[model samples]
Target: MTSPGRTERLVLPGVLTAEQAAHTVAAIAAEQRPDGAIPWFRGHHLDPWDHVEAAMALDAAGEHTRAEAAYRWLAAHQNSDGSWYAAYADGAADEPTDRGRETNFVAYAAVGVWHHYLATGDDAFLDRMWPTVYAAVEFVLQLQQPGGQIGWKREDPEDGGIDRTEALLTGCSSIHQALRCALAIAEHREEPQPDWELAVGLLGHAIRSHPERFADKSRYSMDWYYPVLGGAVTGAAAKERIEERWDDFVVPGLGVRCVLPNPWVTGGESCELALALWVMGESDRAVEILQWIQHLRAENGLYWTGYVFEDRAVWPEELTTWTAGSLLLAAAALGGDEATTAVFGGERLPVGLEPDCCTQP
Candidate 1:
């Protein structure tokens, strides 16, 4: 029933077979255009967040050049305000089908840039990327609401600018993690971005204390686990949060659902949840979560995006770059890769100045 993609490569020791991890890395790199742009797939569109995710996976696999190329592609295409359009055609196209700019999507560049630097220890690469990360962070913070929650997207002026200032809990949690990575980069470079430090603190506060400031997107799985995965939610609070929705988003053998009350299980969300569980120190459960999603694996070592259990079919029919990237990242985290542990587990990244003591630190 699975479609073949490519032969498996080197899998890791425990978390994944060397071949599995290698195939995932190769799948993503194989999809990169000559310009270093990696689409969701060969012919799909490239969004900054997923593009960064795939690039990070490439870095994990020691494909530093390809990863840097991906970042360069992003740098060359970035809008003047440090943002990228929501989507672009697979190649080096400058035009976007959607002109709206997303804060989380734009802000995630910092995470990838920092991760790439950590993986490669390339100071020059970091220097090249700091400006892009700085501009993107500045662009993201420009839309931060007074409540400290960031707006999801700045609507196109023609589409009603002020009316589109709404924010999302999942997106803010993601941005919260990105801000921490940005601060880490700042600290590593000795640039001392006080504003980014303050933003990181405030963003953590918003994620912890001001849930009301964000839109109610509880139906989605990312909303359930992202706070923990993003390092915004931790300790007893993170455990409590996961326990509260464990039944809602998880299926026994299928993996995490993309949404509640849905029979669809997605590879990305499931792998993300595995990473969250690893962060919580539940290695047994996290391993089980990864094992449960093996059904999504294809003969070629790539994975299907999601499966519809009710219909017993693979939906969307695409082996997306980010889905595999998420899986590799989660595996690397579990397999004790230093850079990955530092990036996702928040072990090495510097947490900047503390904000209002409204919640756990």
Candidate 2:
């Protein structure tokens, strides 16, 4: 854990001082397992995507050694087929509690790897993680639907075999972003993956135009903002998409709601929406959105998962690393850090080839 004023690397400014951001990140760092595994919280579960998000925040804060340890835990635990189990008991990484291998969860490692490489300029580290990134992209693409949408997850063989379920817009959009990072990685290594480019293009088309293939998850905030955040859609179209749902997800003077009718203002969703706004070049609104969530922050710099504004109580009563992670990452983006900005702003990664067959008529 880094004390305030100790990070000589990150240039912290207005929204959160260097001390506050460093302290917030320290709370997340304290939860990293000796084997490098990062659970959601002290007693919560470990999911690959959120674990990688928290690890990326660690990288941004000059905690490179610890960040690599987190990646190493993934490298050490990844299944032979390249995907990790959907969830693991807090620190018991020996086996996943849920054996289902989620495509989005499996694919997120590339985002972390590329972000880390940008932060550190460590070619050897990139070389070391490339196979892990390579295998993960391979695994996620196997479930890509012919229409360009990706199925969510495959049940464990013993329970249901390698069956693909319904696709979720949010998940596919996330995988779209992951594919871009993976392609950038392939580009760096001079390994051509033509199939992946076509897959990305079609996947983007699916997210932008063909909402019919995905489950109706419109009630959730992520399904509203993720396509833009994931680079599947951008520019004026992206602005309109978010503006269309502004009132539905945001709670004035509080934060973004986790779900409608819940009265729960979550830190992660709010920070993510701020991130989306930043990518859309609405930094003013982005800053306002971020400011709305500051009430959710604690003195130690760790953040509560959500608040039941109706009851004036923090509902979950849990301080999640990913919650803290999202805030730090958003701050890094707002502060204009090149690497972190590149990750969130759709700038650093190369967009893959468009598939001829998948475009909407």
Candidate 3:
């Protein structure tokens, strides 16, 4: 890991000066309501997923108390099923309207909680969160199909119908990590969670062995890299996947596109691609991706969602929390900063489990 000072040196020049990054992070921390929930934009509603993502960013910035408070908000609001409702309007935790319980979103909390625990080594926080994580995984598993794909959601009345059992590589990949974290938490508590292991194996199998079982979502960069990002494949296979698709979405001096011919290069996808490259042991390429996004940072250290292909600066609209969070994570991975290293549990990229999806017949 880079020394704290060096890591700051690496990240400061391009995005924000180290001092400015710290101030910007602090400003984000201040956005959290007294109740501990951080909304996407000031006074905007807080969704479960983005709340956790922002909290993880706070944790990455070394604001552990704020991060814990964010988790506390989620804990206080958790439903009897150990899941949070899909959405909560600002200033209204007491009467959160459900967008209904989404399986993927609910399951993501485990991954976030585990990530926080890894960053801070806070055993008490881990203990408090384990039950919630386990329950959330169970709820999500109820929606899993025998063909190894998840049904996307279980509770929404409309579009809630099982869309397709074709496993979404991105969703399954995420669940693969969440299950591993949940299992680790289970083991940490010295509890037996056979079911959790089974869930992990099944999800891993779906991601590794069942590409055909998923929808052919080749247009998105996420579809190209998520299995690796989620830790479902590694070693030679990871290299092959990236090599095969390298040129399709990458735009020189710009960034990766969310989808081809979209003519819009997005910060979030670019950062994620950087992280994915890091996971594949391609540090130099990862740094290249980070450098590309460095050109897109705003003065406030925030990033826009996407830049138009024709004129990079034209559509600087829709500054996003996740865009900033993604850049922070990518910087942490590539620069090996103490703060990012501490929060991410390592300076190197995470090694996801080898799912059965990669197993040959």
lDDT of 2 by residue, 172-257 (tens): 98899899999988999999999999999889988988999999988999999999999889989999999998998899999898
- For model 2, state the Cα shift of residue 302 in Å: 0.9
lDDT of each: 0.84, 0.87, 0.70
Q: How many residue pairs clash in each candidate?
A: 8, 0, 4
What C-alpha lDDT does candidate 2 achieve relative to the native structure? 0.87
Error of 1 at 291 (Å): 1.0
Better of 2 and 3 by lDDT: 2
Taking the tens digit of each residue's C-alpha lDDT, what string does model 3 give over 1-361? 1123422633634445566556557556656788788876665667787788778777777677888998888888777766666778776544565656666678778767877887788998998887778778877787787765676655544555333344567777767666666766677678877766666666667776677777778898888888877777777988998889989989878889888768888988898888888877787887777778766676665677788877646365765676777777766666664444432332232233334544445
Model with the higher TM-score, candidate 1 or 3: 1
Cα deviation at 356, candidate 1, in Å, is: 4.3
Candidate with maximal lDDT? 2
TM-score of each: 0.93, 0.96, 0.86
Off by over 4 Å in 3: 1-16, 93-98, 157-166, 311-316, 337-361
Candidate 1 — which residues are off by over 4 angstroms? Answer: 1-15, 157-163, 356-361
Q: How many clashing pairs does model 3 include?
A: 4
RMSD in Å for all candidates: 3.5, 1.7, 4.0
Candidate 2 deviant stretches above 4 angstroms: 3-14, 359-361
